[model samples]
Target chain A: MDTWFYIADLAGVAVFAIAGTLLAFRKQMDGFGVIVLASVTAVGGGTTRDLILDVPVFWLHDATYFAVIAAAAGVTILWLRLKAYIPLNRLLLADALGIAFFTVLGTEKALNTGVSPVVAIILGTMTAVFGGMLRDVLARDIPMVLKSELYATTCIAGAIIYVALSSWSQTVAMLAAMTVTLVMRFGAIRYGWSLTVFKEHK
Target chain B: MDTWFYIADLAGVAVFAIAGTLLAFRKQMDGFGVIVLASVTAVGGGTTRDLILDVPVFWLHDATYFAVIAAAAGVTILWLRLKAYIPLNRLLLADALGIAFFTVLGTEKALNTGVSPVVAIILGTMTAVFGGMLRDVLARDIPMVLKSELYATTCIAGAIIYVALSSWSQTVAMLAAMTVTLVMRFGAIRYGWSLTVFKEHK
Candidate 1:
């Protein structure tokens, strides 16, 4: 089970890297900026979570994540050379999958640290959303999670589910949370569901 | 002496919070957004450093930082209501002072953690600049450090000075580094010093 979880985590990292690379390319960023964006998108959230939990950063402790992100970036570059096109919908789907996996993983890690469930849920959402947030910020765009359809809300819901169910069965909790996240995220994208924007009286 | 350092640290937090509040207000952010921006700009960099160093976050361990930030924000709001204008030069001066103080403090903390000099300098720069970078992102503007004159460069210079001189005399090192940062930063602002922006062939 640990092996499977680790593999899925790496897969999630790769998807995030690809998504970030595509966004950077769209922004006309040079090579250095492209790699930085890809790396931050893949690992930024996990780094934030580990930092807050006062743990050794996962990438600094294990080189495999960096290696995987590099591989993903390479593949993305080659694919772009051939096609010169990446559909926005496909990128969103990839991002959704990564967010679902990361949300559950982050919540489980927070729970293991003995934090309150509310804190765990918050950290989980942070883990899933932070990298993308950084990516958007660096790209000089309003973060999609803040502007788009139900992005962070889906992560929060998935994290809440994992925190609520983990005591009963870890496997069940993980699976249920990931499934629900994917469904809600996909539904939001398909239906264009979004929370109301906050506007103040001038 | 420790009490002096503590007081300076709180002053730095207050300056950062005031700077963030001013920026958010320029964006017409609501009261809640203003507070959020102020808090993040005051504590975000230190939080990032603590997380990276695997140490307890200072603000979480001691409430004084939060209290100072809140007081600063409150004062800025009241002052704004009365004056209806804040000069840009005053804001830049406050930010420069905060950056100089934070760079030395962060470098000292990293050295105490027994890290290498390079890591200490990097962490110091991060501690000084990360909050402003975040404030810019939240406001949907390019970060000043990335685009403006000598912002992060001054922090790096200060951190380097602190790391190089601290083994001889801590007080001398702190004073020397802070003075150098202030001189360089003010010079850059007065003379319009800037690094060349990276551009790639299309």
Candidate 2:
């Protein structure tokens, strides 16, 4: 269980790092800017969570986590330069999957640490969303969560399912959570669905 | 004492908000982007500190703090068209003073709350500089603290001095810490003195 969660964390960081650095490259930013953006996007959310949990920074102790982010950045930057506008659709899908994984992992971690269920859900949402928040803020773009898109809603759904199913084995709980998030997110994107039904007021 | 600290916290936040929003505007950021920068700049450092210390977020509870930051941004955006530069230098001086103030306040708060003096000093340094860190990161610039400019060093010096002088009256400790930071920062800016002295290897 621990190993699976660790793998999920690294995967999330790598995907986030790639996304941030890719954006920087698109903006024609220098190498240093690319690295900074990558670094923040990889660590910003968990760092926020760790700090709030008052846990010693997991990344500070685990050097490989940092290495993966740096490696992801380097690879993504090179890849971006090599390929022209490679359908950003792939990157968006990867980012969505990564967020879903981290969202479940975050709630599980928070609950394991004995935080209240409400706070656990909030933390899960933060874990899923804040790296992108840092990425968007740094890139000077509106955070994807704030857009009409239902990004945070996905995390919330995943968190609720995870909490409800946590009494089951860890693997089953994770599978249930991830399943909910992935289906909802992809379905929403494919169908252009939304919870809000407000018509155009203007 | 409590009243003065609250006022100082407000002042620190306002200064940070002004600086952050101005930078965002300089880049032609939209209204939401401006608010993002302002909020991050005002609360970013303390949020980082709390996360590291594992405390419940003070800002999440205290809406007034966020309100003040919004007000600052609103004023800056409105008045921006009128002034070529809105006393930015003077406002920066105020910001410097606020940094000094927050450093001492953070240290004292941590210390009184039973954190070790060393940890208190770390928190102090965080409070003093984390806002600027968020600002630079959002602006897509490497944090100035990690640069040749001796920003973090000055913060460290001020925190150390404040902790050492804690036995004295509050007025004296505050004055001494503020002077140390102001003098170091001002001298660095005026003389272009930097801490990045590289030794020449023979």
Candidate 3:
């Protein structure tokens, strides 16, 4: 179980790092900036979660995460010159999968730490969204999560479902939660679904 | 001594909350958004500090901080309606003082936790500036701290001074550090002191 979690966590990191690196390229940030953004997007959410839980930060205890982020950034720089061949939706699809994995993993970690189910769900959503938000903020763009989107909502739904299905087998519960999150994200993208914004006062 | 630290911390919170509330008003955010920005600016730095140090979050143990932020936000909202009468520099002045207090206080706290002086100084700077960074990010603006400015440098300078002066009386060391930070911030505003940015590649 631990080994599976570790693999999923690293996969999520790589996806986030690629997304962040791509954003840096779009923003025309320098090489140093690209590496910084990639590292932050790959690990920022988990760092926040561990800090809130008053535990040693996961990445600080291990060097593998840094190496993975560096490799992802290197690949992204190479890919930037050949951008015409890549479809934009490929990054979005990878991001959706990354969010799903992070949401389930965060919820499970919070539950194991004995927080209330409500707080656990919220933490899971935060863990899934904060990295992307930080990446956008550093790129000087409005965070996609806070704008008109179903992004965070999907994470919230998955986290709640995970908590509710805790009585079932751990493996089954995790898979179900990830599937729900991924479906919601893909559905939103495919159908252009978005949350309604409050009308501004005249 | 503890009482003095507590008082300084609350003062910092109130000042940051007011600054955040005013920014929200400028951004034309709704009431709920104003409250969130105020709360984050008031406590975000401290929360980051505690998380890094593996300590229980300060606000989680005390309700007073939240009440203070609420009060500060209410005052700012009322002040917004009477905006023309208020001097434009009031918020900047308050923020300067808040940064100074938070820098010294955070440095002291880090030192108490047995971290090396260099790490303690870095933590202090993080405690002083992260709140404002979070506020700007939430408002969808580039953080002023990361831009051409003397903002974080002032905090870093004060933190270093505080650590160096630790052998002196605690009260003396804290006061000296705060005074230095406040002077640097005021001088920067008065003289338009800013860090030079490296020119972007053409």
Superposed Cα deviation of residue B89, candidate 2 (Å): 3.2
Q: Residue by residue across B117-148, what tens digits does model 1's lDDT show?
A: 99999999999999998888877878888888
Provide the lDDT at A150 for model 3: 73
Model 1 misses residue A186 by how many Å? 3.4
lDDT per residue for candidate 2 within B54-95, as digits (tens), equals: 666656445578679879888877677555455546555655
Regions more than 4 Å wrong, model 3: A29-33, A70-80, A83-88, A187-192, B1-39, B52-54, B59-129, B137-202
Kindly report which residue stretches of model 2 are placed more than 4 angstroms away from their true locations once superposed.
A1-85, A89-129, A133-202, B84-94, B199-202
**Model 2 CA lDDT for position B201:** 75
In model 1, what is the error at residue B123, expressed in angstroms?
9.1
Local accuracy of candidate 2 as per-residue lDDT tens digits, A1-202: 7887899888888988887787787677885999898888778878777666666777888899879988998888777778856566675777688788888878887787777676677678778878888788778875665442467778888988888888777788788888888887787677765653122221
All DockQ scores: 0.13, 0.07, 0.13
Q: Per-residue lDDT for B136 in model 2?
A: 71
Question: lDDT, candidate 3, residue A18?
Answer: 89
Residues B1-202 of candidate 3: C-alpha lDDT, one tens digit per residue: 9999999999999999988877765665653456657877888999999888977877654668877998988877776665523354876787898899999989999999999999999999999999998988878877868873789999999999999987788888888899999888998888888777777678
Residue B156 of model 3 has an lDDT of: 95
Q: What does candidate 2 score on TM?
A: 0.59
